[model samples]
Target chain A: MTEDTKKLLYVMTNGPENPDKTYAPIYTAALSAAMEIDTSMYFLMHAAELLKKGVAETVALKKGGSLKQFINMALENGVKFYVCEESLRDLCNIEASDVIEGVRVVGTSTLADLALDADSVISF
Target chain B: MRTECSREWDTEGELMAIINGCEIPDELHYYLEGSQMTWIRLDGENATIGLTDPAQTRAGRILHVRIKAAGTSREKGKPVATIESGKWAGPVHFPVAGTITRVNEQLELRPVLINDDPYGEGWIAQIKVTNQAEVAGLLKADQARTRFNEIIARDNVKCIRCQK
Candidate 1:
């Protein structure tokens, strides 16, 4: 597809539970912002917790920036963040309304459709 | 150039060796070898690129291959794509500046192609080169081998399974 029409999808499977292990996803989100691609981020499974506001600040990875900063950078850059509903209810134990501001809880099917339709899908 | 003993084999039983110190099977046409990594200059005006055999061998079987979309301009040493193997995910940087022209769809279903045939079916992205002159800056086969050896020596990177 043309550059103007390209849609970059950032899939985050890592959550706040283990920041060190999940650093790749956070870094990928930040890197996507830096690249300025027409980007969108989907937080699935444990990754949904990253939308919990304060949770991102607590997770850190070696040689990488803080999770909070990464998420914030993405949001600031207009990176559309979508939290998986199943993860929000099952893993994070929080309802959709409890999610941080500017984040939306989307269904699994939507995530799947986004993945299938995106020009590029990056899972971290 | 120099040839190393075969460490891996294909179904065809063709003897594969490390040429110019890069893990490129002798069957492929490799114009640039022995630099920090193996790079293929595309047959078209734009250069389609991917990692060399030695680079893929170092990465192990690729589990995921992420590429930037077409028309996206890229700078040298910046990540144009990311590849995952086992538990490690690393970025693939371009050796030259260019605008990405096309990405390989085959990799989405078969990431292992990077291991099975990195230089051939495993080729990654094609770029509409911004500066053709930068091609001269790339390393030759012999130089690439020396550079690969140095990098391997410095990093002391072992195969994923060999780490244990």
Candidate 2:
């Protein structure tokens, strides 16, 4: 929360369909937050599906852990979760009520603002 | 014993409790509330801090550790170090508010030392306590053993030390 605190934005484009790619963003985001960095994950395109209720719960990585576990960890570590409003409505067919409790339904403009403000922008 | 450090401790000491193969040395003070599994060993006004044995086991093999520089002042519940292991990543919160006096720099090159000797070489930091009362507020070894016993059963954790 300090002026010098670094901001990191993770742009997630993959979803439950790509279970392997889903965990890294959340895992690293949680770690970054633990490091006292201002960390956020912006779920866009297929990645927005991960914010849908019951989606992360059903997706388990090949390595024998559930996506829900990492998501919860990230949430507990203060990693901000954001779901693209456009992607959720148009591409994912997810209503605001269908999204998980912790995620914020934000617009593309918010993502642009976050990216511009961030010290690093990583895409998954 | 898994390592020289553990072997040196009096394994049969009356203060030590072996719960599910994890040693809880009652001689040290513990911060077992929530998932903050840290211990404080007081030496005058300076307190030595480290992750508990069960903590290292749960985290699996520690891969990286980044501790705050010495002389950094921190409040209670703030992290003195951030640890990343094969299975987990999180902050190692200090029980007492103080200024950092020392950090285990050896952990940078040999992070697995935490898994090998959690009570010894795995120690994270030392702090010159700002509040001596906070140091006393930490759980004693006996209380920590009772609590950790329940936690180990609930979490189904079996303490396993890595051969280093």
Candidate 3:
């Protein structure tokens, strides 16, 4: 709703297994930012793997172009992006160094912070 | 309620149209004094403002609107509101200096009215004039009609979907 002026947190937990699911976070995040709403997304579990270098570049959703294009579209509009640290290690044995530039890898405490600050949470 | 700066809305003027399909209603005041896309309608010292038809057509389907709050003072050419489509985002600049009286609340849920009816329900804001002289600089109906026709010809743009 346009009257909602609070922050939004989108949890992008669905990874490339169902490629169609990956686009909604970026699409919605960017549109919200354009409307001047505060918005952010968290990459948890398998979705954390998407931030691994070379992963997003290779993943194309049903919408055609690379998913990274959509991710960049969100970033360009100022939607903050974060990745879960535990998921990087537990799910894929990936490290913070492996993530692409612009994505911040943080601990679960950060996710908690996001959850507390957000007025709405969306699980994608 | 007509004033030195206010002109009554002309029903006959609404019938005039650009040969190429741009609808520059004769009664609406096109703000030629600054950047040219915003239109104004003066009712006494108050006014309603919105994008010109060509502007809405150019923007495509607007999905969201964020207008300045009521009681905010706007300077000429400053943003009074902003709108976005999936592919584009831009501000709707004020045509004259005034204090905002109201915004179209319905736009929160249905911004496409900007594309559906640029002239009527799509109006972005109502302002209480603080400077009537600024309003004086606005284009009158005959001039606005001619100027908007020229705008359509020069920009080579067609009016998009509009109901009445």
Candidate 4:
């Protein structure tokens, strides 16, 4: 990445329960990465539930394609995936091993740092 | 009609094959990544690149395009542009390493040019070659025809050009 390469952070708080709200953030993050921005998606609160291996595979919008497809698109474009550790362990009752691949589990402090360092932050 | 220039490598006036209604021009080289198709035309030390007819058809109607500016250097397999269409959105990868010399500015106004004339007016970028060897292995017309035919059948694609 160049010095001028912008950093973008997308925070998703919705999960499988809100399938309508799930796709846009990951899709936008993928597009941002394709634009050569250093883009990342952070799944906080219930959002971490979608990261569970089988959950995303079954989640899809009415139009078509599962949530895993968008997740793969984001990962393929070099977008970083992060999940809130507390949400994973306490809220979702899932271990780090239960989530899909290519995700980093991090503490609340990391999200704070990411929000501070990011050039732009969007929440969903 | 756009007039053609006479060059040994130019495929204009050649009887391009229509497999599954997709035009595969003779002599133009291609790069296929999964189902995505990109083509490269070598001109001395420079190369012109764009999506193939089947790729544009598969993408449906393009809505937006963002190309890297001229003078930007990109490695082979890196994106030269990001295109969004009704059905799909992603990067258009560079077939060979080079510094971009030009981008199709017309796309900003008429992104559907990608659907209307993917091989001609919709050409994406011109590159000044930094490594000639990387251009050597791209699939030529006959080779690409075989592959595109398989993909067309497998994906059940029937190419349709948008009316101007």
Interface RMSD of each: 8.3, 1.2, 4.8, 2.3
Clashes of 2: 1
Q: Which residue pairs show backbone clashes in model 1?
A: B23-B54, B33-B144, B34-B143, B34-B144, B34-B145, B35-B144
lDDT of 1 by residue, A55-99 (tens): 777777564336664565456545688888999898779778778
Residue A52 of model 3, lDDT score: 88
Off by over 4 Å in 4: B1-20, B33-36, B145-160
Question: Candidate 1 on B100-162: residue-level lDDT in tens?
Answer: 888998999987777666677788888886877777776666666665565555544332211
lDDT tens digits by residue: candidate 4, A80-116: 9999999999999999999889999999899999999
Point out the higher-scoring one by DockQ: 1 or 2.
2
lDDT of 2 at B134: 84
TM-score of every prediction relative to native = 0.48, 0.87, 0.51, 0.82
- Report, to 2 decimal places, the DockQ of model 4: 0.29
Off by over 4 Å in 1: A1-124, B1-38, B42-44, B155-164
Per-residue CA lDDT of model 3 for B7-44, tens digit only, reads 11121234434535457787888776332477899999
lDDT of each: 0.65, 0.83, 0.75, 0.83
DockQ of each: 0.04, 0.49, 0.10, 0.29
lDDT agreement of model 4 with the native: 0.83
Provide the TM-score of chain B versus the true chain B for each model in turn: 0.71, 0.87, 0.80, 0.87
Q: Weakest 10 consecutive residues, lDDT, candidate 2 chain B?
A: B4-13
Candidates in descending DockQ order: 2, 4, 3, 1
Q: What is the TM-score of chain B in candidate 2?
A: 0.87
Q: Residue by residue across A1-124, what tens digits does model 3's lDDT show?
A: 2365678899889886767778777778876665557889999989987888888888876634568766766776668889999999998789899898888889989998998889889887
C-alpha lDDT (0 to 100) for residue A100 of candidate 3 = 85
